[model samples]
Target: MLKRLALSAALLAAVAGFARAEDVTDKLKTSAAEVLARPAADYVESRVEIKRGDATIVGTLTLPKGAEKPPVVLLLHGFTGSRDELPIEGTKEGVFSRTAHILAARGLASLRIDFTGSGESSGKWEDMTPQGEIVDALAAFDWLKTQTNIDPAKIHVLGWSLGGLVAAHVAAERPVVTATLWAPASNALYNFSHFLGSEAVEKAIASADPDAVIEIKLPWGATTKLKARFFQSLVTVDPVAAISHYSGPLLVIVGTKDTVVTPQPFAGESFLAYHDGPEGLMVLPTDHAFDAFTGPQTVDLMAAASLAFIEGK
Candidate 1:
């Protein structure tokens, strides 16, 4: 009986090891498919840094395939988000990924990165500000210019949510090839205040520690130990003013049914006002995240429209 038990244990261990190996192999195969099937656009994974006095802000850059000098795009994500948001399984296979890959198909290279302390990045979120994030995007652009495969004059910035604010600011400061903001904030103060008033936000605050406090009076009564500089920096940011100075093609997309940044009251004319360049506006019957990308839309209008604008069609 003892010998039989020992044999059974060994067999189970061998089977478990085989199963684990198979799982790993499957993941690798899936990843390879995603890359190998990446159309004509080539891609590379790299890193960059932005000097902030003695500190260096770091980020990742994913370049598309092309032999000649390619147009480079800097992709920015919203607060409490990272580049991972773009590559998420469903999200990636849906609109944003398709949009990016299609850009690659058109010879545009995109650099999607995490902010300091976000994702694989270093630095504390409390130590970063919206302005800091913009500076980082600028740094990524500078790095792109140094690459032999990229055209300095063909650089663009694509910001999503709060990232839009960052992209707008960068476009204003640099000679970007184009610009796009996905469900961007019309006004920092308004958006922040709006979020505070939401039921979800109230729950977050209620569940937070009582000792925490925010520097700025949030729209919601809740507060946190979030640094004072972060709040102060946001108070002065004006996305409309920032984008008003950009002359390249501009694309603004927002969901009509978005409750997070409510389109009708938050977007509408305000979006039309700042997008003075060649512009495109897409209002989908979706939410902030554009969950509709998962549906059987055949082709995502937002992605199609964005790709068309970015490719200058």
Candidate 2:
């Protein structure tokens, strides 16, 4: 039954054209491929298990070419992203994966994993929660600590979109990570409301009832009970509050033209209020995904700033 619902959701996402998150990932992949035709240092790509009590979260770990302890950075994808879904740029890597490769090339080990129920992990997305994802991250951190070539004190967390919220929560809970957020949502309530409302409005701006937005039913009819719970739980979460409690190195990046997660109107003050140190926030002259691949320049900036912050440079 769960598998059926998941499949139906995928079909609906495809038909409804509601999956804007990955709308441009394919383009980014094509662009990245052209940028990554050359060879860099050797790296290992594998799956690691993170145990959260009864459930095991499967994750992808990418290791740099080295035989000694290396600074480790954990990369997290946005909502609805998979471990392999992130592009490694056959020629030009996408932002998330590009950062991972850059870290590996600079002698840092990186790991980007799937959420508990998404990607290749063995769970149902309907049963997952942001808090559950946080536990998965902790499990990953513990696993990384056991690696022979990973330095525990030099660990960092980099999250994009929804992953940024989870990253902030994990950093708050652990308090030992150097954290970076790319186009992260701060106030969960406002964020979700704006997301649903904006998408609905974009589709209904010409409708007779302008206020009547977000009128879509669920994949299996009305909103599933589980989805209701998910939204309810998410509505109460506050990533900005979580980050405010974290006292480690932090960074935030946002595109100036981002309509999906624009920080200016929705979360600008929250971003400013929470980052309490020598943090970095770069506003790129692009859209939500940084569709403008002017030489992978935006991602390159994020990588450089993150490395500097993690190494206290």
Candidate 3:
């Protein structure tokens, strides 16, 4: 975003020193790609669509080379974000794009979709709800399982922010291999109530008008209209409980300055307390979006950790 190419290169080179030992033994050693900034190669990408009722969920499916049936990772973006997301403001890469390429380098396939209404998908923003997102995520999972080339049993999910909440429910519902959440909003009501004031949402829902929509400004200074149902989902979805039902390993990544899902390590720590399984939590020193405003160190740390975890390393 703020031209961190120099910083990314420096940190990645230093990190490479730590991987020298593994490079000699590991089957697919880490690539030469500089910290989450890499072009799409060694993989094949295609446009894919999933049907949810009358709406079409558009996505980009990435299939990595080397593996005859590569394992897949479902990449879920944060709230109000698209499939590839905002590209870190200035760079040509966003979170999911880097994740897809990095995983591809390690012989892992990925599918990043525009969850209904937010990206290239067809739906109204006012009608978007957590429950609906769960439905869409499950539909994507179902579709992925039917694909001819990908390994059906090794599919994992990686979600960020509010999408983490949806990913939780999706993992709980599906027989996923592993579940990874980056800066997840497990306590939906608590997190939204702090950012999206509960008073205004309650008032809009109480209105007799069925078409009632209220305009609220996001923390990033953008105003958006929301229907009453979207607010109700804040109280309805329980991702913490959902995580408990998922039998696979869980990885929760967060930063110390994550104001959206505040209190840092504790918010992440709570996620493991509810679940009984192999779990990991990576806490960085940057903000919610993994050092979007700061340098790329935190993001690099997270990307490395996520890759290792998903690779079962």
lDDT of 1 at 25: 22
lDDT of each: 0.62, 0.63, 0.75
lDDT of 2 by residue, 269-298 (tens): 355455565554455566656563345665
Position 72, candidate 1: lDDT: 72
Residue-by-residue lDDT tens digits, candidate 1, 1-313: 3543453355344334321110122332333344334456456656666565555656555566544777777888787677735333344353444555656764667777777766666677667678778877777777777777677778888887888888888989888888877888766654654654333333333544533434434443644345545544556798878888987777777767766564332353365465566665555566776664455242244544555566655
Residues 142-167, model 3: lDDT tens digits: 99999989999888998999989889
Q: Compare candidates 1 and 2 on TM-score and give the better one.
A: 2
RMSD in angstroms, candidate 3?
9.7
Runs of candidate 1 exceeding 4 Å displacement: 1-42, 47-52, 86-99, 198-225, 265-268, 292-301
TM-score of 2: 0.73
What's the residue-level lDDT of 17 in candidate 1?
A: 34
Model 3 / residue 100 / CA error / Å? 0.8
For model 1, the local distance difference test gives: 0.62
Span of ten consecutive residues with least summed lDDT in model 2: 17-26
Candidates 1 and 3, the one with greater lDDT: 3
